[model samples]
Target: MNAIFGWSVLALVFLDELLAVAAFGVWGWDRDPRWLLVWLLPIAAMTVWFLLASPKAPYGGPVVRPLAKVVVFGLASLALWDAGHEGWAVALLVFSVVVNGLALLPSIRVLVEEG
Candidate 1:
């Protein structure tokens, strides 16, 4: 049961990250082809690590690290949106980042047995 929930949460995290990357690629970066590869590399690396590490539940150092990645991606996305003069894109990206972060926080609490 815990394993299933953990995996589900992990999948959500991965999906959120992918959406962020894609958002950055499309709206934020002005659909730059080169930027797509650059944006995907860290996600690919994280996917590999997640598969190999095989956590029973989403806790510990690794879970926290992904949040940082999300923040970085969000900031980069904001910067790109600003560069492109897209105000709506910036708001949407920021909202996504906040929502993803909030979703992950509950899982962290569960993992830590704090709630």
Candidate 2:
């Protein structure tokens, strides 16, 4: 991959995580000191995401990759919508799909050929 393209993919991944945090943070914006729930969502999601879908997943399997991507991105959209940011949710949904598709094209291609 081109260096620029690779950087953009990394940027998108970072942005996705930030958006997830923001989505939940919005809900805990003015809540009581029990704001712990707000932070936990992203932490849990990122943990699962990194383990299952990271480029360097501790375990390897074709099935886990795409499935994890969908699940994580879907959770993000839900979080945004739940927090009353329907616009950002929809935008993230679209952006995640596009960027993820492009970023994982090589892996996807291999899977397609094997299947």
Candidate 3:
């Protein structure tokens, strides 16, 4: 279970990064230079924050922190998607939710186990 959780978290991280890159690329092609920076800053900040906060690798610990971060990022993506109304933004929002949902699975499992 720990191994699965670890790999799933890794996958979510990978997907999140990939989507971010894709969003930047699309923004560049669309000639919206500002969005490239906009998309990167938050992700970079979150990556740093996550690394610092989970220094001991807290995947198997309580789920609240991870869930909170996921919710925040998911909402941010959704807001961007809604604001742009572009296909790429929509795709990014969907990808964010799915990846975050996968990341949340371990927490959900923990909740079930506790009950």
Candidate 4:
């Protein structure tokens, strides 16, 4: 049961990351200079993910890692809201909180640390 929940949470984290990038894309779609923003925003978001959120990221450390997650997810949620996806924005925020909360549980954390 612990392993199952851990894996599920991990999968959800991946899904959240993808959804954040998509949310940025959605926002860029409606802005001026669509050609640039449509591609650029997601690229920037991915760069941040690679630098501060990935498992092997160098700059994350302890504080910066969680802070980066908050910044990325927060911006993504705001982007969704700004792009007329109010419900989706709220849902994404709520989903992130719940998923991260679950992942931090001792049982799941143990599985992750061991694996």
Candidate 5:
């Protein structure tokens, strides 16, 4: 059951990240197709994410991981908000802080502990 719950949480987080990337892409595409950034921004975000925030990424030392998460997810929320998705942005923020917090907090480590 613990394993199931843990994987479920991970799946949700993965989907959330994908949604964030898409949100950024949509925002960029809306602003100006002529600007190369419309495509590059989301690509850049994904690259930075894989490099710095993936579970096994070499750069994600414990100290750096949380900060990287904030940068990645925070940028996603901002992208949604700037794209006129204030509700989605707020929901994402709450999920990141609360859901992720539930998984990360040592006293409530259900989503991360071994089954």
Candidate 6:
């Protein structure tokens, strides 16, 4: 049970990360400099995730890592909302929170922490 739950949470985490990046892309699509931003925003988000939020991030300490995750997710959610994707924004926020919360559970923490 623990193994299944752990893996499930991890999957959700991955999905959330992708969704965040996609949200930025979606928002950028509706912007003035569509061509530039469409490519730039997702790339920027990916860079930030790799540097600060990824499990294997070099600068991701106990505090900074989680903080960076929150900020990134928050920005993504807001970007969606501002882009007239209010439903998607709320869904991403709620789903991200739930998955992150589940990842912190004692039983599943080990699996996620290993990332």
Error of 6 at 108 (Å): 1.7
The model with the greater TM-score, 4 or 6, is: 6
Give all candidates' CA lDDT scores: 0.53, 0.71, 0.54, 0.89, 0.75, 0.90
The lDDT, on a scale of 0 to 1, for candidate 1 is 0.53
TM-score of 4: 0.92
* Top model number, lDDT: 6
Best by TM-score: 6
Clashing pairs in 2: none
Candidate 1 worst ten-residue window by lDDT: 51-60
Q: What is the TM-score of each candidate against the true structure?
A: 0.41, 0.75, 0.42, 0.92, 0.80, 0.94
Collision pairs in model 4: none
What is the Cα-based lDDT of residue 97 in candidate 5?
A: 75
lDDT of 1 by residue, 31-55 (tens): 4565675566446545543544223
Select the stronger candidate by lDDT from 1 and 6: 6
Residue by residue across 26-110, what tens digits does model 4's lDDT show?
9999999999999899999999999997766878767887889999999999999999999999999999888877877888777
| Candidate 1 wrongly placed segments (more than 4 Å) | 1-15, 27-67, 82-85, 104-115
Arrange candidates by TM-score, descending. Answer: 6, 4, 5, 2, 3, 1
Tens-place lDDT digits, model 3, residues 18-103: 56545444344444465675566556545643554232434424565565555545554554564474666666667766765665
lDDT by residue (tens digit), candidate 6, 11-97: 989999999999999999999799999889999999999999887898888898899999999999999999998999999999999
Candidate number with the higher TM-score (2 or 5): 5
lDDT of 5 at 65: 73
Runs in model 4 deviating more than 4 A are none
Candidate 4: C-alpha lDDT:
0.89
Q: Give candidates' CA RMSD values in order.
A: 6.8, 4.8, 6.7, 1.4, 3.0, 1.2
